[model samples]
Target chain A: MMKRIGTYLLQSKYAISVTVLIFVVLGASLATSSFLTGDNLITVLRQTSVLFILSSGLTAVVLTGGIDLSINNSAALVGCIVAQLLLLGVSIPVVILAGILVGVVIGIFNGLLVGILKLPPFVATYGTNMVVLGISTIVMQGKVIYDLPRNFTPIGVGYVGILPIPVIIAIVLTGVLYFVLQKTTLGRNIYMLGSNAYAAKYSASRSVLDTVVAYVICGVTAAIGGIVLTARLNAADANMGNSYGLQIVAAVVMGGTSLLGGEGGIFGTVIGALVLTIIMNVINVIGVSSYLQSMAVGIVIILMVWLDIFTRSKREKLSRV
Target chain B: MTTKSLGKRIGSLPPAVWMIAVMLVFYGANTKNYFTASNFISILIQAAPLFVVACGQTIIVLMQGTDLSLGASLNMMTVVWVVLMQKSLPLSVALPLAMGTSVLAGYLNGLIVAKMKLPPFIATLGMQNILNSVALVASNGSSVYHEHAIYKIIAKSSFLGVPYILWITIGCFFLTMVLLKFTRFGARVISMGGNPESLKVAGYSPDLATIQAFTYTGFMTAVAGFLLACRVESGNPIVGNGFEFNSVAAVLLGGTSMREGRGGVGGTVFGVLLIQILKNGLVMMNVSSIYQTAIIGIVVLFAIMLDAYIKRRQEE
Candidate 1:
């Protein structure tokens, strides 16, 4: 029975993430009554919505065996552009479209560098990150754009019946992405390409286009995250997305997406995002010093990746036996 | 025929050398103060610590790994040094302790990458966070100023009309050159980058090479941190911010292949100089800091793209 259970655990995609989430939730609940409360849970979900969107996009890139460090900066730049446009009395829809377009352009640029030019993804995205940061700074001049339009706030804070709009948006995007990843031939191509690009080449999978599309999707999602973030804060700043880059990476990796690529799903990412949010919430509830939060995050990331490597190797050994 | 061959030789020189020559000609024509020896010395001084740090990054990159946490590690070392000095510890004691902390930080990063088989980028990213937090905790989020007579003397004093910092930087370059060219360890590092599996097949542990490379990186970053602290006379939490990217840019700009062992310290020196010169030239040209960063970004992109094109052509 125990062996059967072990096999079941290994077979299910969501099993490990679900198990981890349950433990985290239970731990949080036991630590403080505030954690289990409906209000706090909603708050956690609301806060996680932006990260969820960002990580969803990052997962696609990781699955393609590439990374988009520029996502956070792209989001920040988009937010800044949207905020500036709104301040200039542009229509909200136009501003949103412009932000997303900017993201797509940046994404295309990254795709060209990584896909066609064959530049290393890390360095290429890092260069794009710097360029975006510079543009964001030039646009805002290091100042915060606050007092956004009242209509824009709905996207961030408005409720849809019992659920927050951001949470709803996150859910819808996750569902769409999950479908695209699971049901489409393109999705299969992406996995195959990431798993072994050399083999994928001979298979004629249009791997280059697949890589480009992955980054484009990543960029669009990050832009959406930026818009939500700007609305939520009622302000935009060039530095707003600086921390999100590493955070998204953490979430995507913790979700069981291999950095080596081609082995994770959106369901795992959602649980990973939740785990991170809950850890943050627990830290807040316990009144841990804010200075230690980054340290905690770093430790969690290392532990998660280490656990991943350990488990995969163990499985390999067991299979060999 | 001789002239054609000479032209070809010049053409074969690393892009950084050409960049330097062009910038020199352009800036020499455009800015009146650009050609002055004093201005040149100032540029060297500014580039000194960055050169040291980039040397460390180059070594790690040569091993097909990266150390994104170097900037944070540098900051932590600086903070520790200053905090210890603030507690009335002598320079001799505080300096070694701070340096030791850097070695430990590097060792931890090496351990994660070598033992756990985590990608260097992710491992170093996590290490960066941890080190940044440690720096914050050590400094309590404030800059610490120290103006000891000995500290100032070491940083500011000159020998043979060159700044002490410049001398230290030169010493570091010589040391790195020797380590890379004269040591078996260095050969192993390059070989590991060229092919990790082959090293294992050859009965050498790539893991040891990885650890040693990171340890060297950690040591140099600590030295750079010390030099920076001495120069600024303060240990600010944000002092080392953005350095990781800058150092990586310099290393790559120097012609080091991001993939593995295709470049070395010779190109890296020129890369560091090119960045410093660019910054100095921008300042002289009155370009806004924001535009300066953007231009640097563009330059890095252009350099890598050009390198890629050249390499592809060669392969063809």
Candidate 2:
């Protein structure tokens, strides 16, 4: 019975993530001793909250076989906007509303390019990333604004009865996204579009035009991630989210979403995010050099993709035999 | 019948016409000095290295593959060349050595993608990381400075009121154009890109074609690195960052299909100019460098979308 349960667990994609997470927790708990304490655990959750939110949005876009490389830049720009407006004494709610709106606008722009114009996703986002970076730089004049109000800070750091507000928000967002991805008509359309757009159009009455909305959601989520990041840092810098674009894509893909699209889920992505966070924390704990860390991340990425490919082809060979 | 053929030819111009027209308008509006001999020459000189790099990138993209490692490869060449020159080797020797390393890098990228059957994106991205690390290590993470006379002549010194780099860029363009248009190898490349499986069935090897494309990209990256080294009169390990994007942007903007099979060095020429001019114009107009990045990004998006629209209309 134990062996059968083990086989079932090991056969799942979530297994790899679970194993990695366990290794991290065990390592952290052993080394720091303070690591498994409630406060430290809460700190890890809070740190991971922003990445989770961003990855959720990116998950939707990748589902449609598209990527949003401009998210980091978009986040930077939105964060700068949020900071500038708050400095102008704009209310917290209004700042939040404006931030979400800016993300949607960027999303709409991405949608127009990919959906209507049919430009390749990689190229379209590459261009928008530069634009967003430039805009953010202009807004902040290459400075970080640090004078945010107390209410703003709580969205990232505040807790209610041992659970952080950001974590709570992340949980709610995940549930909502899970529903949208699994149960909604729009969600199914996205899967159809990513898997086979032509077939979807002919069979499911899916419009390529409307499928663009998914990318917008991806953009907005990235913006929200930016807001959370700004709150955590208590400032908005021009290049703040720069490292995220590649990392989030790595996390999503590692979580089992195909770069070719139409596979994977948020549950896997959450684990992926947690695993990534743990790997990063482990790297820090182990005191790996920053330069070497890039090489390590690159290696891990290649290995994950290689394993997926090998397993896929092995299965294909087995079926053929 | 002749008019119909002419109409078709006009329709096929795609994004190049708009890029050129926009460049001219932007230049004219932004500066009274736009058409002056000095300014024209300056723009060409500034665009020289990018144009040479994009020439290589154009060939690879024509084969329906991309070389994201171009910038990283260029950085490697720059560092190597700088170090070799520093070791008292003549500029001539160091330059050839740098070019050779680029070819090797390109060859490896081609091998991984063609032989190992790795996706071009993953292969090139891996090559980018490896080369980026090698470049940092080669220079020990510092810029290498030298003052060789020949190097100065090649990178910075001008002849007849034009930079030597401009001449090199033009020379490379003409060579690529001739090779692509007149050589059997070039014909084979276009055919392979058009349909690799069909080409294979017809007794051509797609692997060989892919390798050739990558090798060409490597060689051009070296040429670009040489120009950059001379222009700055030094080689900084990190100097080549964003070069791949610039090259890709130019190639795509110039009407080269990302899917390969349909691109030319000629269109890439105009595309390179358009990118360089847009950047220079932004600087000239006193737009902050930060905002300029955003503006360029937006313009590139517009350029690609415009290209897509033109292609769609042509199909209809």
Candidate 3:
């Protein structure tokens, strides 16, 4: 019975993440009773909502066997642009639309570079990131744009019966993504392309177009994340989204998504984001030095990646046996 | 016949060389005294440390791997060196200790990639974060100043019309060139990049070559960091910020293939010169720093695309 349970655990896609989540939750509860309180738990989920949106997009790109290092930069640029537009008296909806459109255009450009020009994803997205940073700096002139209209606050801070708007958005998006990934032909093509591009080629998949679309989804979601963040803070700066680049990558990797592509689901990413959020919250509650936070995060990322690799190899061996 | 051959040779030269020449002429036309010997010497001085760093970066890139920890390693080395110097440790002890730390950092990176089998990108990225934090913690997030005469002398002293820093930079490049061209390890390094499977079949360890490449990179980064600290006479935690990307950009601009095994230190010299000239030219043209970055980004994208196009055409 124990062996059978072990095999079941190994076969289940969500098993490892669930185990990790349970461990972190229990540990955090032990560290501080405040961690399990409803208010703090909601706060953690609210903070994780923005990262969830960003990671959802990244998961699509990663599922296609490509990465978009520029997602954070794209988000920052869009946020800055949207903030500027709002300050100029543009309506909030129009401003939001403009921001997302900007992200889509950048995504299309990245798609062209990766799909059509055949540039490596790292180099192409890195170049795009630099360009976006430069442009954002020029737009803001290295100053933060604040004093946003209050109407913009609802998407970030508003609550419907004690549930934050951002959390609701994250949940709805995850459900939509789950549906698309499981039930759509394009989604299946993305998985196939990531798993084996050579085989995908002969199977009538429009590989390049699919790759482009995946990046577009990544860009749009990043832009939405940016918009939400701007609303949360009621401000935007050139460097605002810089930290998100590495953080989002870490969360996605921790979520059981393979950097080499062809495997992973959005649900795993959600758990990954939650785990990271809880870790940070615990660190904060425990009064760890801010300087050491980065070190802690880095160590956690390495450990999680090692654990992932170990489990994957074990699972493969078991399957072969 | 000689003239035609010479024209062909010039035409075949990397795009960076022509870009440098064109920028020089443009700067000369736009800025006063841009062509003076003093200004030229200053440009060379600024390029020296960057050239050294790029030389190291070139080797790692030839192996189809990257060392993103370079900038953080530089920052950490500067912080450690400066802090030790401030504590009244003799320069002799402090300098070697700092360099040894860098070597250890490089070895850790190599172990993670070579032994643990992590992708170089993720491994180096994590290392970058760790080293960055170490630098911050060491320096307490503030700049450490060294007002000693030795620091000034090392930065400003000249030997036969060349600065001491310039000499050190050239020496580093020369040593690396020789290592790449005249050593068995060098051959193995190149082969490891070009064909790892074959290297394994031949009974030589690619893992050792990877470790050696990273170790060499660490040494050069330490030397460059030392030179930078000397020039400024201060160690700021952010001193090496953006340098890793800049070095990668310089190496790529030098016509190195990102795929590995197809570039050399020779082209990297011209690449370094090209970037320095562009920076100086933009400043002389009164362009803002932000716009300069945008322009450089555009140029990088264009160069990489053009390289890809050329390779594709050749294949066709």
* Model 1 per-residue lDDT at B30: 84
- Candidates' lDDT values, in order? 0.86, 0.78, 0.83
Put down candidate 2 lDDT per residue, B175-200, tens digits, no spaces.
88887889867887787678777787
Candidate 3 matches the true fold with a TM-score of 0.95
lDDT of 1 by residue, A219-278 (tens): 999899999989998999999996676778888877888777878888888889999989
DockQ order of candidates, top first = 1, 3, 2
How well does each candidate superpose onto the true structure, as a TM-score?
Answer: 0.96, 0.88, 0.95
Candidate achieving higher lDDT, 2 or 3: 3
Best model per DockQ: 1
Q: Count clashing residue pairs in model 3.
A: 0
TM-score of chain A of 2: 0.90
Off by over 4 Å in 2: A1-11, A16-44, A197-205, B1-7, B75-105, B115-118, B122-151, B158-162, B182-185
lDDT of 1 by residue, B234-291 (tens): 8878788777888887887788876668788888888899888988998998888878
